[model samples]
Target: MANTVNIKIDGIDVSVEAGKTVLDAAKKLNIHIPTLCYHEDLCVAGNCRVCVVEQEGVNNLVASCAIPAQKGMVIHTNSHKVRNARRHVVELLLSEHNADCTKCYKNTKCELQDLASEMVINEHMFMDLVPDKNYTTDKQSPSIIKDDSKCIRCQRCVRTCHDLQHVSALGVAYKGDHMKISTFFEHPMYEVVCTNCGQCVNRCPTGALIEKNYLDEVWDAIYDEDKHVIVQTAPATRIALGEDLGMESGSIVTGKMAASLRRLGFDSVLDTDFSADLTIMEEGTELLTRLKKALVDKDTSVKLPMFTSCSPGWVKFLEHTYPDYLDNLSTCKSPQQMFGALAKTYYAEKKGLDPDKIVCVSIMPCTAKKFEANRPEMRDSGYQDVDMGLTTRELAVMIKQAGIDFQELPDEKFDSLMGESSGAAVIFGATGGVMEAALRTAYEIVTGREVPFKNLNITAVRGMEGVREANIKLENVLPAWSFLEGVELKTAVAHGLTNAHQIMEAIHKGEANYHFVEVMGCPGGCIGGGGQPIPTTPEIRRKRAEAIYREDEGMAVRKSHENPEVQQIYREFLGEPLSDKSHWLLHTHYVKRKRV
Candidate 1:
């Protein structure tokens, strides 16, 4: 019956646990408190005083997000004095912000514009400072754009780059009005150590940070009579796409998504899950091969603790921060790229179409995929394998632009070639899913038996811990994998680059003894990716993850190697996993960058 503290917000009394901020209490009562810097994923940064509220007996209004609820505390969220202070804060931010809303990418979705309209601030209460700021926009990055003119000095992006990601690519420089977020020496984002993960874009309150959208280019390609556009939808995109399309969070729209893309005039609608299963086959074999060499042949040339290379953000993080460990990363391309290559080559040959006319587009839940698609090495198919990448949010816009009634759309299946997938591929959307999927296939391949887990679910590698470890013992192995018999395969999973940094540190200090590692660049894996729906909180991520597992359980085929299409591909085109053809199409290398 008793909580740690009691507080009154706008005459409504509510009890909350200790350490709960006033903002949290207000949320419990369904009270709205406008915020620019107060993001749930980042640490408390009271830089923007937009959430200021009146406190009884206090000389100055307190920032509700930074102030913890004390016992018997009285708060007024919309008192006359509180409104005036909050208004002034917005006015100051607007004066400095490039209030050119119509020309901005985030025009209708801009939080400042909404707040300005909500407050009814029709007149310019202060002199416009945009003309004097002389801010510059950096448009060099393939994945992101950093515009200083629209920034309100909220520091949400700062906290995300530093606290959540540990990649400090953006930080505060100078002081007061002269302050601005800048990379090392203010270099262009592409030239600096920025991973182009786009976490900052997700947290930015204004148009200061945004993904470099290729929607227009993709539209042009679709309209071209010579081009045959094929779109591949990522695993995570299906579960989260509904959130922005007027559907509930965690709604599995796989069938609906396929249907929508078909209606949108795509030449072909495929599944990225097909390549996801292909990745598992290749990555799992590579892991076992490395083990055979390191254990049987005593080869020191092979790298232990082989890291998964599916996440481009994690790959770039290593390229810049831990270049020496480049060899540790698996040589397999991401599911997106693998599909891209196969689309232009295998699919092209199968369909009797020209590879040059086959344009591959991806619907992914990552901004890093945009950068990954543009990497020179991705031209493994002899052309730009992936022509463009669209985030889940971007796809939702296209669905809207086409005026399709998404909720009423019927469930449809993907096209034949490069469209089939197993349940293992579906789990790639969640953290620890890669390790779990790899084990399910590798253990069977080595031991000739299913992995010793309940209902074929390897729960060890699944959860929300920043870093997790699981050790599986291989027993009763086949002749070729006898070297792995009685060997304990140690693997670790990490989501978010900060956790990846921690895991890498442990391996560097000789504290970790893992043989395999799985790292996803975004927190909660791709479900909580930077290109997911707006306001992607912890609860939404949990929902999306649950939807993924439910989808896996509902599938008839659960293992990667058991996928009929995968077996068919190996039998008809690719001889086997890690074959010469597979290597040429499904494998690629990484670039090492000097940490600036």
Candidate 2:
């Protein structure tokens, strides 16, 4: 129960929980108050003052997003004063911001530009303040570009980096007119402890923060006559790419995605879900081997609570923040890297195509995948394994550029050889999906039965909670996997770097214990990735997750081990998980980065 407060807006009566912001109360009435600094996923920062409202008897307007509604309060969200104040606020934001909208990466998608259009601000309302400052643009990072000129001093990125992520890579550096967000020592993002998660890029209302897109490079690769360009789409990507292309959130556009990629003239359009299934195989085997070493051989060097390494953002976070526990991470490369490596090696050998002519591209739901693809260790195929890492947003751009009506395109299946996937791989879009998927396979491998849950759905580990835990008792184990029957296996799942830090602290303090851990750098895992869609919210992520689980349920094959492509690959190429060749192409090491 909550203390309900009654409030009036424009003579309409509204009742909401006590201490709820005026903006929240207005939202119940469907009153759309424009905002820039405010984000549903972050702590409220009322500094922008664009969401101001006029309260009866109050001479000055209050920020609707910050002011709590009280009993009998009369609020005017669009009163003359409020409208004028909001207009002036937008004008002020534009005064300091570079209004060169056409040249910006965020162009039509920019929030400030939207506000200007709504207010009919065709010209500056005040003196141009952008000329007074010497703004700097940082394009050194492979994942993100930081341009101070486009920043509106809105602190949304600052709050997202600090409060939501607990990664304070960006901070306000100066005061008043000189105030700006800067990294420590103003070092380029690549030179800092920034994990390149792209949460800041997602929250930014302006072009100040944008993923460094490789649209031109990818277009060039597609145009090369002698090149064999192949693109792999991630599991999360199909669940959200429709949102940017005029479809509703949670729309499964797998067929449309494949068709659009083919329309764009890619040599092959594959699914990363295929390699996601592969990851489960390699990672499950690694976990079983580690358990054998720790419980059976009493190996001192074996690390328990093995962490999943599917998220490049989480991998980089661990490298910078928990360098000493690098061994705890599963050595299996992410599905993207695994597919990239195989695209050049196994696929090339099977197709009899020269590896040099093969250009491997990945359409990911993450910006960090771009940075991950560029890592020196990812070059396992001798040349750059993954030539380009395109975000879902970038893919939408290409689709729009090609003039293909995405919704009108018919659904098509992914190409053979490395495109087939299981239901378990599809759920990799959600937060706790990895833990549930792994347990679904590992528990079966030990007990020789489907997971005891209904229809192989592990509900215990499937959720939106920050840090979740589950316990499974391995019983009636197969003779080969029998270390000790009746062993209760403990596992944990955490999404978001902040929650990851909390779980890691608990593990370090010996307050909590587990045999395995799943960590995703973003709030709701890959479905809520930094590169999925702009304006992602709790509601939007929930919809995407629903789409993911629904897609999983509709699939004929629900377990990773059941995928025939995986079985064929094992039989034809790798032989088994963690083989010598698997180590050469599917796994690598991590380096401890200097802590800031």
lDDT for model 1, on a 0 to 1 scale?
0.92
lDDT score for residue 245 of model 1: 90
Tens-digit per-residue lDDT, 310-366, candidate 1: 999999999999999999999999999999999988899989999989989999999
For model 2, residues 477-578, the per-residue Cα lDDT tens digits are 999987848889999999999999999999999998899999999999999898989989999999999999999999999999999999999999999999
How many pairs in model 1 have backbone atoms within 3 A of each other, for residues 3 or more apart or on separate chains, i.e. clashes?
A: 0
Q: Per-model C-alpha lDDT, please?
A: 0.92, 0.92
TM-score of each model, in listed order: 0.98, 0.99
Candidate 2 minimal-lDDT segment of 10 residues: 158-167
Model 1 deviation from the true structure expressed as Cα RMSD, one decimal place: 1.1
Model 1: how far is 431 from its true place, Å? Answer: 0.4
